[model samples]
Target: MGAPRILVVDDNKDMAQGVAMVLREAPAEVESAYTADEACARLGERAFDLVVTDVRMPGQDGMQLLDVIVERWPRSKVVMLTAYGTVQSAVEAMKRGACDYVTKPFNNEELLLVVKRALRERQLEEDLQRLQAEFEGRYVFEGLVGRDAQMLGVFDAVRKVAPSHATVLVCGEHGTGKELVARAIHRLSGRKGPFVAFSAAALPDTLIDAELFGARKGAFTGADHDRKGHFVEANDGTLFIDEVGSMPPLVQVKLLRVLQEREVLPVGSSTPTKTDARVVAATNTDLLRATREGRFRDDLYYRLSVVRVALPPLRDRIEDVPLLAEHFLSRRCSERGIAKKRLSHRATRVLLLHEWPGNVRELMNVIDRAVLFCQDDVVEPKHISFDEEATAADLSEPQSYEATKREVLERFQRLFVERLLHECDGNITEAARRAGLTRAAVHRMLKRLGIAAPHPEARRG
Candidate 1:
C-alpha cells in the first residue's frame, strides 16, 4: 500500500500544520491547507488518500467544502475537526458525506485511529465496488452484523444459497432482522426482478390468501379489479414472507402446493400462475416443534429448511453493540441534525450488558431515542433510557429454584402492567380494561411497581 496522503484544512496556518505534523508522524504522507479553497485546489491537482478539514473556516466553510469533496472526489476520505459544543457542524459534515469527525483538541491517538479506519473502510468499499462491477452483480452482502459462531454458520448458508436457486428458511425471534438476511440473499442472487415482501402476521387470514395468491375481480367482495399477488409480482425475484409461521393452515397448504407444483392458483380464477419466484420464508416460532405438534406441516417445513439460516440475537453478539450503535448514530445524527455524538465507553458497556430481548430492531429504537433527546455530543449512560424492569429481569440471574420462581413471577407482573399501560397510553382505566381489571387494581399495581404516568396522553381515558 502506498503512503496515506492526508490533507489537513484549517483557517489558522499553525493549526493546519499541527494536524499535518500529527499525520506525518504516523506511517502516512501529510499536507496542510489554510483554507477550504486551497483544499479543493489540492483535491483537483492530485487525489490525497484522505482529507482532514476544520469545521469553522473563513469563506466557504468546511461543511460546504465537505459537500463539494464528497460530490466531486468521493473516493477521497474526509475527517472533520470542530471545536467543543460545535458538534452540530461536525455532524453536518458527516451527513454531507465526510468519512468521520474529530473534536477539537482530540487525543492524538484517537484522531490517528479514526483516520486510518475511515481510509481502510473507503479502500474496502472501493475494492468491493470494483469486484462487483467486474463480476456482474455478485454481492458479498451487508447489514447482518455478527462474528458469533452461530451467525457465522448463518453467513455460510447465505453464501451457498446466494448464487444458487435454493429457497432460504430463516428462523429467529421477532426483531432479529430476518428481513435483512433475506435482502442479502436477494442482493447476492442478482435475480433482476423486484424484491417483494409481506408479513403474514400483519395481515388477517382472509386477506393472506388473496395477497399471496392474487384475487380476480369481485373475489368475495373488495376485489374491485384484477390484482397480482406477491408470488406473481415477485416472479424472477425473491418473495420474503415474514412471520411465515403465523400463516393460516389453509394458506400454508396452498403455499406448499405452489412450491411443489411451481405454480399458483389465484382465488376466483380457474387458471394457475407459474411460480418462477425465489421464496424466502422467516418465522419466529419453533417450526420443528410446531410440526410435531401438528400446527405446522412437516413437508412444508422440510422444503423451507432445505437451507435453514438462524440469525444471532442482539444479546448473543453483544460485542457488536458499539459498531451497531455508532452506525445508527452516524446515519441518524446526519439525517436528523442531532449533532455528532459517540457513546461513552461506559454507556456502551451498559448497552452490551443488557439482554436485548427485542434484539437488533429494539436496539436501534433505543439508540435513536437516546440520540434524539441527547443534550451533549457524547452519549452518556443517562441518555441510554431502558426499561428498568427489563434490565432488572435480565440482570437478576440464576439462583435457587424457589427464589428464581418468585423473582420470575414478580418480573412478569411488573412487565405485564407496564405493557398494558403503555398500550393504553398510560390511561389507568383503559389499561385496567385491557387487563380485565378495575382502575383501582391497575393503580395499585402501578404504585407497587413505582411506575408513573409520564405523559398526559397516557393518562387519558
Candidate 2:
C-alpha cells in the first residue's frame, strides 16, 4: 500500500542506474541491480511490486531469472528489456510469465506507461483474489457460486424461508439455477421424506393430472395399475414442480385445491387422500402477468408465490464470472483426472466480456469444453468459444413489448459488430469499410455498446 517497490536489473551499471532514475518519476521505491544474480539476492530479501530486467545479462540471463521469479515469487511482475533484434525473445519471455516487455531504445514515457499498466493489472488481480478467498465458502450455497448482491439476497431468503411450510415460487430465466435453489431449500427444510421433482413443461396436458394427483387402477387409458402421484410420492417432503406456469387450467385448479385441502383427490377415486407435501414451484414465465392476461388463475398464482425468490440473469452479475469459471474449470479437471489448468490473462478477459446468455449452465459447458480441448496447462483465448446461436431467454418479469424489442436489437447489434471487428482483424477502418459504414460511426457504436477498441498491436497480430 506504500509507494510501489520496483527493481531495475541490467548488466551495465550505467544503464541500470539510468532506468532506476527514470522510474523515480513514478515516485516509487526504486533499486538498481548490475546482474541477474544480484537481482535474485535482492528479491530474496524482500518482495518488489515490479522487476524490469534486460533480456541479455552476463552469466545468468534475464530469461533464467524470469523462470526463477515465476516459480518462486509468482506474484511479483517481471518486464523484459530487449534490443530491437531480440524483441522476439522478449515476447517469448512474456509467454513464460513476464508481464510485459520494452525495447532498448524505448522512450522514458513508453517504459513508464507499460510499468504503470502492469502494476495496475497486478493490483486488480490481487483484489479479485482477496474477494474470492473471502466469499468462497460463505457466499456459496450448495452448488451455487456467487457474491453478487442479488445472489446473496437469494441465499439469505432461501435460508430464512427453508424451514417454514410455505409454498415457494422461484422465478428466473432458464439455466439461472432455479433447480439448484430448490434443492438447497429442500436440503435445509429437514423433511422426513425424499425430494420429488416434476416438470409440467415436460408432460402432456392429459397426463399432467395423473402425474400430480394419484390414479386408481382403472382411472383412465394407460392406468393399468394403481400409482402414486407426485403429491403422494413426495409426502412429508419437498415437491419441486418446474415450469409450473405451463400447467393446464384444470390442473392448476386441482393443484390449488390440493394446497388448500392438504390432500389430493386421485382420478377415479371415491375418497380424497390426506398428504403433507411441501411445494416448491419454479417458472421462467411471469405468472402474475399470466394471471392478469387470464392465461393463469390469480388465486393459484397467489397461493404458489407465498415466498417468492427472484434470480437475476448472468449479465446482471458479471463480476462473479471469474469465480464461477474457476469453479467449473477445477471441477472439470478433477473429473477428468488431469492436472489443474488455468486461464491466461487474455482468456480471462474473453470470459469477463461475454454476455453469458445461457447463464451458469452455458459457462460450465464452455469451461468443460475448454478443458477437454486445451493442450497446455493454460487455457488461451483461442480455446474459448461462445455459442453464437443461443439467444437470451425471455425475461422472467414482464416488460413492455417495445422495450424487449429494443433490448434484443441491441444484443444483436453488439454481436454483429464484434464479429465484424474480429473478422477484419480488429482494424476499425477495415471493419467499417467491409460493413459499409463510416469508421466514426463504428467507433461511436463501440463506445455506446461499452466495447473496448482493439489495441494496435492486437490488430496487427
Candidate 3:
C-alpha cells in the first residue's frame, strides 16, 4: 500500500550501496546489506517487497539466500546480480524462485528498470492473493476462481438469487463454465433434493421428451420400464438442463407447460403428475436470436430467463489466467499424488498470451497435461503445449476477408519469429540478424507477437 521496501545485498559494501542508491531514484524504500546473513537479519525484522542480491557472496551466496527467502518469506521477490560469465548461475537462481536477474556491469537505467519491474510484479502478486482470500471468505463457492469484474458480478448475482425459486438461464460459450455456475446456484439454494443434470443436445429429438417428462412402460420402443423424468427426479431441488437451445419445438411446449402448471404429463398416461423442481437452464447459442428466427419459442425463452447469468470467455479475462493455471496445477498434482509444481515466469507469460477459445475447461486440461508431463518441480515453456488444431479450427470459421488476412499474417509472424529464436537457441540478437532486422526491432516484434524473450543475458549479442 505504501512505498515498496527493497533490500540490496552484496558482499562488496560499495556495490551494495551503489545499487541501493540507484534504486532510491524510484519511489521505493531501499536498504543496503553487506552480507547474506545481514540480509536475513533485515528480512527477519520485517518483510521487504523485493530483494536484490549478488550471486556470489562471501558466506551464504545469493542462491542459498534465495532458498531461505523463498521458504520463509514466500511473498518476497528476489533478483539475482551476476557477472557476465556467471549468467548461468543467475538463470539457475531464477529456476530456484528468483523473480529476475541483472548482470554486474548493468547500467543505472537498466538496474532501475529491472527493479521497477520486479516491484510492480510483487504488487500484482499481492493484489491477486488479497483477492483470492476475499473471494474464498465471502463467496466460498467451490471450483470458481476469478478476479475479473464480470466474474465477480456473476458471483454476486448467484449469491443474491440462490434463495429464490425463479428459473435461472446461464449463457456462455462452450467450456466457459456455464454448468459450474448452475451447480453453484444449486448448491447455495438450500434445497433438500439432489441436483440432477440433463443435456438436450446429448440426446436425440425422439428421446428428449421422454428424458425431460417421464416415459411409461410400453410408451416408446425402449421404454421397457416406467421411468421418472428429470423434473420428478430433481423434485424440491435444482435441475440443470444443458444445451437448452437444442430442445425440439414440441419438447419446448411441454417444458413450458410443466413450468406453468408445476406438473408433467407422462407419455402413454392420461393423468398428469405433480412436480416441484427448480430449473437452471444453460445454453451456448443465442436464444434471443433463435426466438426471433422462429427456431426457439419466445415464450419459453422468457420463462427460462427469470434470472440471467452471462459468463465471459477466457480471453476477455486474460489477467486471471495465471491464478487459474496455478489452481489447476495444484489440484492436478494432488490428484496424481506428486509434489507440487509451479509454472515458470516465461511459461506464465505464454499462457497469458494464449487466446483460450476453449475457455476455462481448456485451460484446466492444458494444466493437467503439463503437470503430468513436467519432470521437474517447475513447469517451463517446453512443457506447455496448446491445442493447435483447435486454434486452427477457430480460425477457419466464417469471417471477413480482412479479418482472415490479419489473423493469418499474425499467426505466420508468430511462427516465423518463434522458429528464428529456436534456430538461434533463444538468442534475440542473432535471430534479428538472421531476419535482417535490428535487435530492438526484434524485441518490438516479440512484444507484438506476445512472445516472451529468453533471459536478459541471453539477449546480449
Candidate 4:
C-alpha cells in the first residue's frame, strides 16, 4: 500500500545519487549502491520492490547483476539504465527478465511512467499468487480453481450475489466452466431443495416444453403419467439452464413467463403451480445478437441477465496454467492410487508455450491423458499430446536465434487473432475493435499465416 521500495545502483556515486533523488519524488524508499557487490549486499539484507542499475558498472555489470537478481529474487522487477549507444544491451537485459529500460539523461516523466507500469504489473502478479496459495484446495469456491485477476473477480461476484434471488446469467466460451460457477452460486444460496440442471441445446423442440414444464398423462404422443418439470422439481431451490441461447421461440416465451410469474403450467393442465426456484441461465453465444437476429427474445435476455458474469478464456489468463495443470495431474494420480506423477521441466515449458483453445477443460483433459500415457512417474514432453492441430512447436530440437524468434512471434499472432475472433463470435468489426487493429490488417495477417477463424463468418469479413 505504501510507495514501492527502490534500489538504484551505479559505480559513479554522483550518478547513483542523482537517479535516487529523482525516484524519491515518487515518495519511494530509495537506496543507492556504488557497485554491483554493494547492491547485492543490500538486496540480501532486505527486499526491494524495484532495482534500477546502470548498464556499465565496474566489476560485475548490470547484466550480471540482473542474472543474480533473477536467480536469487525472481519476484523483484529490474530496470536498466543504458547509455545511448548501448540500447541493444538494454534490450538484451529485457530479454533476460528486466521489466524495462531507459537511456542515460532520461526524461523524468518517461522514467516514472515505466516504473509505475512495472510496479503495477508486479502487484497484480503478487495478488494472484496470494489467491492461489489460499485456494490450493480443489474447491476455491465449490470445485472451481483459478487465481487470475479475472477469475478472482468472478469469485468475488459469485460471493456478493449468491445470497440474493436475482436471476443470474453466466456467459463464456464453451468449456470455460459456466456450469461450475452456477453450482457454486447454488451451493452458497442456502436453498434446501435439490439443485437441478437442464440443457436447452440437448433436447428436442417438441420435448423442450414437456421436459421443462411437467406433462400430465397422455399430454402428448407418449405421455404415460404426470411428470414434474425442472421449475416444479427445483421449487424452493435453484435451477440451472445451460445453453439458453438455443432455446426455441415457444420455450423462450414460456420461460419468460416463469421468470415473471414464478409459476409453471404443465402440459395438458389448465391449473398453474406456484414455484420458488431461483433461475440461473448460461450461454456461450451472444444473446443480444440472437435477439437482434430474431432468434431469441429481447425481453427474455434482459430478464435472465439481471447479474451477468463473464468468464475469461484460458488464453487471457495463461498465468494460471501451471497451477491448474499440477492440480489435475495430482488429482488423477490420486484417483488411480498410483505414485504421484510430475511434469518434467521440458514438459512444463511446452505446456506454458501452447495456446489452450479449449480453455481449462482442455487443459485438464491433456493432463489426465499425459498422466495415463507416461510409463514413468515423470511426465516428459513425449508423454504430452495436444489436439490434432500441430500448433505446438517442437522443442526437442534446437534452432537458430532468428528461427526461434520468428516462430514464437508467428504463433503468438495466430493465437491472439483466434482468441479475438472467438470472443467477438465471428463478428469482424467487433474483433477488430477489441484487437485495436483494422479489419484489413488482421485479414492480411491471417491469410499470410494460413490461420482460419473458428467461426466461418469472420473469414468472410
Q: TM-score for all predictions?
A: 0.61, 0.58, 0.58, 0.60
Q: Which candidate is the best by TM-score?
A: 1
lDDT tens digits, residue span 1-461, model 1:
68778888999998888778878766788888888889889999998888888878889988889889888998888888888536676566767898888887888899889988987887798788787465332222366665555666777788789889887899888888899999989988989888999999868776899999898988877888988899999999999999888888999999899989989988899999897899999988899999999999999999888888888776656556666778778778999865679987556655765678888888888898888778888986668877443453343233443454444446657777877777866777778788789888877877888888546753543
The alpha-carbon lDDT assigned to residue 262 of candidate 4 equals 91
Q: Highest lDDT, which number?
A: 2
Worst 10 contiguous positions by lDDT, candidate 1: 392-401
After superposition, the stretches of candidate 2 with alpha carbons farther than 4 Å from their true spots are 1-134, 389-461
Per-residue lDDT of candidate 4, residues 59-133 (tens digit): 899899999999999989999887853767766888899999888787888888888888888889989888866
Which candidate would rank higher by TM-score, 3 or 4? 4
Clashing pairs in 1: 425-458, 426-458
lDDT of 2 by residue, 65-168 (tens): 99999999899999998885365776688789999988878899998999998888888888988997777768678788898888999999999999999999
Q: How far does residue 453 in candidate 4 sit from its true spot (Å)?
A: 24
Ranking by lDDT: 2, 3, 4, 1
Cα RMSD for predicted model 2: 15.8
Cα deviation of 54, candidate 2, in Å? 41
Evaluation by lDDT, superior candidate among 1 and 3:
3
For candidate 4, list the clashing residue pairs, or say none. none
lDDT of each: 0.80, 0.87, 0.86, 0.86
For candidate 4, what is the TM-score?
Answer: 0.60
